[model samples]
Target chain A: MPKPMLKRSVQQTQTNNVLSVTGNQKQNNQNQQMNKMKIDKLLRQKRSKEYMDALHKLDVGGHVHNQNKVDEITNAIKREFPEVEISGILLGYVSICYLGKPYEVHTLDIASGIIEHYKSGETLPNGMEKARGIALHGGYEFIEVYVDCCRAVSSNGTVSVISI
Target chain B: MSDRVISQANLSYIERNLSAIHGEIQALENDVDAVNNNVKVVYDQVGVLANEFHEFVYEQKKANRLGQAEIKLVQIRQELEKKYGHYDIVRRTTTGILQADDLGIVKKTTISNATEELMISTPNYWLAPCLVALSAWISDQPELAEKALREGIKRNDEKTSLFFAIICMRANRKSACLKWAQRYLANQDEENLDRKAIIVIDAYANGLMGADTEGVISREMTKWLEELAEKPGFVEQQTTQWTEAINLKREPIENSGYTYLPKYSNTWPVLEDILEGANLHANILAYLMDIFEQESSSAPIKAQLDKILTSLVTDFDDEELPLRKKEKFEQFVVEFCGDEDRARQSMAIEETAFETHKDFTQLLTDAAMKPESSHASVATQKFAIALSKEWILNAYNDVIAQNRMKIPTEIEINVDTFNSKTTDGQNEAQLVNEFTQLVTKEKEAALAKNVLTGFDKFLLIGGAIIAVLGVGMIFGNPLGGFIAVIAGIGMVIKHFNKKKQLVINEENIKKNYEQKLENGLQIIRAILAEVVDFRIEFAEKDDESAKVVDFLEQITPDQYVKNLSTSNRRIKM
Candidate 1:
């Protein structure tokens, strides 16, 4: 399930610039659409590193420490992509719930650095389905990050998202 | 009439409205049809696109450029990230490459290096990089691979732990393999790589220990390897299909590359791992021992391995197997490398055959008893004969395989010989004698009984006449007396006939018993002939010809052939 988001708030920054909060909610109370975040090079690099660290941590099987570690990672991700919802940390990877569906981003494509997700009703390539089952049953966690834009980010990395 | 006069205008208005409504309905129908046609066109286009894309994918695969295709997919993933902000993309290019790796393609250092770079470069994508590191180690670049593995471990990556254990296994770094394997077992999910880690630890520990005191540990390790080879690895997804298809036409792909041998202990473990569990065979143990001896040249390792395999190498005679089951148990152990269950099954079958043979021997002894003319005795003889024939036929292959007895080519039973035994155990002379005996006995008994019965009938008739005469005198009626006398004569004749038939039935019973006894003897003789023939055929090939005949000769008329407990009676008759 998608995490409950903070009510959309428009605040005047110290610089008098307007900032709005957007997250997993379907619509703002004012019925306004959430705008996609813009990805600049430096931001991508920073987010990419954080995502890598998160994945590294997940790989090392350390996700089950406590809510604090999860919150820390969740906050870091929320900072980068405010619209991405963190439902909970399951198995060591953050579960990014979308539209009431949770996708596990278990491994990265070394070439593209994109985290993999398996949605319900989607056919996995042959043995991967079984492997996914094993990984899930083995307490493997997944991290799936999707912004309104085509790009997705984890604390350690940024990747372009596509449906295969 | 006046009210109806204004209604014409109203009618005109209603008609106009109805016409307009009909036109609107027509328009709606047309619009619906157009929409349906447009949907159809879109579906057709999608189908074409999907087919074209599938074809393109197939072509790329055929050209073996799946690596490049994966790279392209990764680029698309990156493109999505650029447009959408950093996002998670599934079924990514890495999955396909990993499958290719399982097919022995991903082990190319260049490919693993590329994957490693992508993984290291990607933000927060740490889980898959450990796999890339594994590929590197597989490709013979251990240093960088170990570094990546360490990083994953630092990140608390469970996959990295498994990879490290596997890496340790490949290097023959036994202690490290044990450490990482135990850690992985403790922390790894039961569903994931748990079985794999267990298999590795079991094999390594057992293998490294060589042979424990009983050699049981090594055998267990071999069995574990056999079972492990049957399990499908993660990347085995596509290759499994490819291998199945390929196997239909040619040899199967050796493995899914999960347990490919690594650099350090590549020779023994790699060879051992890829044996498809052939290590579990007795010959394999012997072969290994032989090669080990040749390779080590009196090294301490030789002493250890020798101790380990000595029990395995011991002959069946030296082992604890029963003497009766030694032959079959030996063959089974030698073939299966002392697989206890199969050996036991084999021994069980041998035991059953031996028991059957013993039962047939006892039956023969019973059949040889004098006065074996009873119905039950005859049935026993028939049963024994049939069982002996079946036993010989069934045991032919087993005996030959075990080298217990050999039948020369000329010894095979011809159709005429088989028919001679199968038709009737009795010779023509026995049949004639049986028929003659039944005829003679029936004729003699029938003549004597007929004479006596006839005489008694006459005497009864005379006595009835006298009594009827007296009845006439007392009643003073001749008609009544005449009728009474006729009835008395008919009753007397019927009783005499029944007595004569009883005498004939007794004679028939006597004839049947004699015939049965004769037939039973013939059957026993035929079965004994077969046994004697088999012995003769076997004796011709025996170095100790006299021993074979001597065992057969000891089977006296009163004793069962099996009861002759001579050492030379190895060939069961």
Candidate 2:
């Protein structure tokens, strides 16, 4: 319950960092630690606009394209789960996990699918601690992902759904 | 053995060695005491620093949102103006026509020439033709007025009818006002009334429509209720919405009020929510009463008509809704920049209230409460509340029941390194005992780890025995036995000193733990007392719900019309 997961196994196949030998682990092993620091330094330099473009090819929040997609999926989710008065759909990437292993980044749809699974007797998504009746912040509910990046209300009909 | 000789200097030397070990123990005890004493102060400083960090983040977010939202506004306005320029002109011209009368600078012919120019310039614009009809009607040109009115109505009948209705009311023509209003209402689907229709309803409910004395509009309202009631789950949906709306009126309790409960109690989230929920009963009543108590607008008829017309002009046309929705969403920077969750939730509610048509209940409620936008007068608020009292009460009841079920039997208070619990503050003695037990278990575990082993104790005792044997042999073998005596004496002194240090270490552990337990007990007592106060306050607030009920009971729609009706103006006629 502490970690939100993806419904699709394909989504959880640990995204390989081809450039780094160390997989972001900070451990007691000196060799791994040194290699991790070296790899992280390189990655930090690779955060230029061109690198970001090459890595994030799908463009999770590409304004018009993603906005339209968010609108489409938001409507679908609302129709499918009318009881959940979603405020709006957000299209962005979130980090998720399978079992206990983390996949540093995944499309928001992976989390969306997990929520759909939550509706059908599967485990509730990890970040949604304030879902449904448990919600109390202003009589509105929220999902707060306290873990690093994976931090994953309608009014009396005043609010709506989020898709991405 | 009977008379082993020992020197006075040797005895004084032993006294000095034992005294040094006692002094060393005292130093370690003092160090532990100092650390224990500073724990609480250090913790308080950390808490303060955390609050300061929170303040920094909040301010930073606010500043960022401001900049981002400003940029969004500039972009949105540029688009809104470019695309909706034709619609914009109609709204601006409507206000100008009314303002021109007071200015008396523009002559009748000049006004005619301008309206004709606008019509030619903005072809196929609906309200432009409506403005021409209004100008013709005012100028007493019957043929031109009829022709323009037909054209305006043909373009948008609902808005044109509403336009003429407000104009007729301002001119004090009661029969024409009534007929035009009924015509506007006639075209509306009860469930899908135009967004602008709310303004008309607000005016009617406030008794500004002097002709509705015979209950013609009242019958239409009753018909709306009948139709809404016939729809399945309609009442339930209203209940949920009304509950949320009423809950929204509750002001949050100050965080510092129950300062330590949030820090100590795991149940604080639920506890906090229940307190607010309990307060809702009083808060919502006061909100409604405040509405009822505010003074009604007494603006002269013409001036009031001008405000209504201005609002109508500014209201978006059906064609502009898609773009307007985007504009409205971009209006808030935090939402526009990245806090899409808040933006989405807010827009959902806002869209419900102002963007689209809704049932009579929601329309009237918005008209009553969100008066700046919905334009419901004070009298209309009273009328709407009295009309929707049943739904309001049911929703309030549902909310109360839901909160009651979440009440926990026992609250768990988690202070640092201590887990204290209580069913209520009455369990103070039990809580103190439990904390002491936990402290005892911790102290015992630590002392156990540092205690001298069996071999060290055997060496300490065994060394003194050997020292005595060597002293007995001192007289027997003068130099050789004396060397054995010195070696045995050194071993005994070394272990005895070590044992003394271990005793001091044990005492320090005991003092440190006992002091920590005392601090935890103090925190528990302070937090427990607040828990008691919280319940008492919750009860006092919960009892105030009856006041809202009693207040609502006194409200009647018929009584409101007397304060707001234009019948006084009509009687003089």
| Strongest candidate by DockQ | 2
lDDT of 1 by residue, B335-393 (tens): 44435466678778865632322121232222322113311122223322232222222
Q: Candidate 2, overall lDDT? A: 0.63
Residues B298-391 of candidate 2 have per-residue lDDT tens digits of: 3533355556566677788777788787777767445555455577788889877655667787776675556566566776777788777767
Which residue ranges in model 2 land beyond 4 Å of their true spot? A1-164, B1-164, B298-359, B372-376, B414-420, B432-450, B461-490, B502-524, B561-573
TM-score of candidate 1's A chain against the true A chain = 0.32
Stretches of candidate 1 above 4 Å error?
A1-164, B1-120, B127-150, B168-175, B189-195, B198-488, B506-573
Error of 2 at A78 (Å): 36
DockQ per model, Cα: 0.01, 0.01
Which DockQ value does candidate 2 get?
0.01
The fraction of reference interface contacts (C-alpha pairs within 8 A across chains A and B) present in each candidate is 0.00, 0.00
In candidate 2, how many Å is residue B406 off? 2.3
TM-score of 2: 0.48
Candidates' C-alpha lDDT: 0.39, 0.63
